[model samples]
Target chain A: GAGVSQSPSNKVTEKGKDVELRCDPISGHTALYWYRQSLGQGLEFLIYFQGNSAPDKSGLPSDRFSAERTGGSVSTLTIQRTQQEDSAVYLCASSLFPRGPNEQFFGPGTRLTVL
Target chain B: QQPVQSPQAVILREGEDAVINCSSSKALYSVHWYRQKHGEAPVFLMILLKGGEQMRHEKISASFNEKKQQSSLYLTASQLSYSGTYFCGTEGFSGAGSYQLTFGKGTKLSVIP
Candidate 1:
C-alpha cells in the first residue's frame, strides 16, 4: 500500500517569498493533516481536512498561512511572505477516516528554509 | 496544551527496560505513541483510548490513565532497533465534532548493545 507522499523534500526561499508544499495522501484516505516541526520544539499542528468539510485552520499561525485539500485526496499548504521563523519541516499525514484512535501514516516531509 | 514528557532523553543497554511518561493538564480523549529514527517519518506504535485501555505492540506497551490525564510507554528488554525518539500525542475534543492532537517534546531513547 502506498503511503502518504509530499513533494519538494527541501525548499529554500528568501524572506518575503511565497512557497507551496504539496501532500498526496494514501489512496482512499479521507482525512489529511499538515504539521510543522521545528528544532527542539515539538510538532505543531497546522491544518486538517476531513473529506469536504471545512478545514481546521485554528492552528495556522497567521493570515499568511492557508491550505486547501482538493477533491478529497491532495492538499497544498501555502505560506505567503515567508519568514525566518517559518523555517522548519512541514509534514503531512493521513488516516483512513475522520475518527480518533486511528493510525496516521506520515510522509517524508518538506524542509523549508527561509533565508 | 502540549503534554509534558519526562526524562527528555534516556540511554539503556540492549536488554534493559525503560519507561517514558506523558502528562497533560487538560482532559484527553486518546493517547497516541509514535517512534521515529533520525531522518525518518514517524511510525505509529499504538493508541490508548479514554477507558484506560492498555495496548501493546511487540515489546512496547502503553497505558492510559484517563482520570490522571497521563499515559506511560513501557519498553521491556529494549532492543537496538528501539533507538529513536518517542512522542506521545494527546487528542482532545474542541467543540462540536473536532478533535486535535497535541504532542509532547518527545523522549529520545538510545539503545546501546
Candidate 2:
C-alpha cells in the first residue's frame, strides 16, 4: 500500500459485543502506532510496534483492550465488552524509521460507535 | 498531558488569515501540526525541532519555541480547501522517551467563501 490502511471505515456494535480493527502499514515502514480519540478529546496513545520486538503496550486502556502485530506488517486491535464510552475514532500510523521521532503517515481511521 | 489550544473554533472568509495557539506545561523538544477534515484522518503538516525553526507548507505555517513549550499555527490567506480541524502535537524530547506526541483537542476552522 502507498500509505497506512485500516479496515472497516466505520463499525457500529452493541455494548456487549467485541470488535477488531486491522491495520496494514505501508511497505518497508518499521514503526506502527495506534491511537483513539473520543469526541472532542485529544488523541490517546494506545500502542506501538517496532519491527519484531515486543510491542510497547503501555498505553492500552484496560484488560479488555489488547493488540498484536504479526509479520512486522499488519496489526490488529481488539476491544471486548465494548462500552458506550469506548466509542471513538481509532487511528493507525506508520513511520519508516526504527527509532522514529520522525514523521508518521496515518490511515483514514475507523470510527466505532458502541450502542 | 494534553496540549492547550485556544479559541476552540474559528470562522473565516476565503483569503482571510487565522492563528491557532498550543501551549504545554512541560518543556517541549519538538512540535508537529496536523489538519483533519470531517470524518477523515489527520494529515501531517510540519514539524519544528527543539531549536527555533519555522516550517511552512504551501499556505500553512508553524513555529515552535522549545523554551516556552508553545507553538503557533498560521493559515495565511486561507482558502475554502483549508476548512478543517487543526491540531498541535507536542513532544518533550527526541530520544529514549517516546517521540510520540501529546495532541491538543483541536481548533475547528471554517473557511467560508
Candidate 3:
C-alpha cells in the first residue's frame, strides 16, 4: 500500500513569497496532521483534520500559516509571506482514526528553504 | 506541552542495550514512539496508552508509567540498523474534543559494530 506522501520533496523561496506544500494521506485514513521540524528540533504540530469536523489550527504558528484538506484525503499547507524562520521540513502524517492509540504514518516531508 | 526526552544522544555497540525516556509535566493519554534515519520520514515503532500498557516490537520494547507521565523505550542487543533519531510524541487533552501530538527534540542513537 502507498504510504503518506508529500510533493516537491524540496522547495526554495524568497522571503515574502508564498508557498504551498501538499500531502496525500494513506487510503481510508480518517485523520491527517501537519507538523514542522526545524533543524535539529522536535516536530512542531501545525494543523489537524479528522473526517469532516472543523480543522484544528491551534498549532499554526502565525496567521500566515494555514491548511485545508479536501475530500478527506489530500491536504495542502500554505505559508503566506514566507519568512526565513519558516525554513524547515514540513511533515505530514495520517492515521486510521483521530482518537484512540492509533499510530500516525509519516511522509518523506517537503523541505522548504526561505532565503 | 512537548514531552522532554533524556540524553539527547546516545552511542552504543552492536550488541549493547539502550533505553530512551520521554517525560511530560502534563497528564498524558498516550505516548507514541518513532525512529527516523537521516533524510527520511519517521517510522512508527510503538504506542503506549495511558493505562500503563507495555508494548514490544522485534527487539524493541516500551513501557508507559501513566502515573508519572513518562515512557521508556528499550532496545535490546542493538543492531547497526537501530541507528537513528528516536522521537516520542505525546497526546494529551487540550480542549473540547481535540487531539494532537507534541513531539520531543529526539534522541539520536548511534550503533556501531
Evaluate every candidate with DockQ and list the scores: 0.72, 0.57, 0.74
RMSD per candidate (Å) reads: 1.1, 1.8, 1.2
Candidate 2's DockQ is 0.57
Candidate 1 lDDT over B1-113, as tens digits, reads 89999889999999999999999999899999999898989899998999856899999998999999999999999999999999999999966467878889999999998
Ranking by DockQ: 3, 1, 2
lDDT of 1 at A29: 93
Return the candidate ranking by lDDT, descending: 1, 3, 2
Off by over 4 Å in 1: none
Candidate 3: C-alpha lDDT: 0.91
C-alpha lDDT values of all predictions: 0.91, 0.86, 0.91
Clashes of each: 0, 0, 0
Interface RMSD of each: 1.4, 2.1, 1.5
Each model: TM-score of chain B?
A: 0.96, 0.92, 0.96
lDDT of 2 by residue, B10-110 (tens): 99999999999999998787888889998888898988888756999998888887777889998999999999898888876434466556789999999
Whichever of 1 and 2 has more lDDT, that candidate is 1
DockQ winner between candidates 2 and 3: 3
TM-score of 3: 0.96
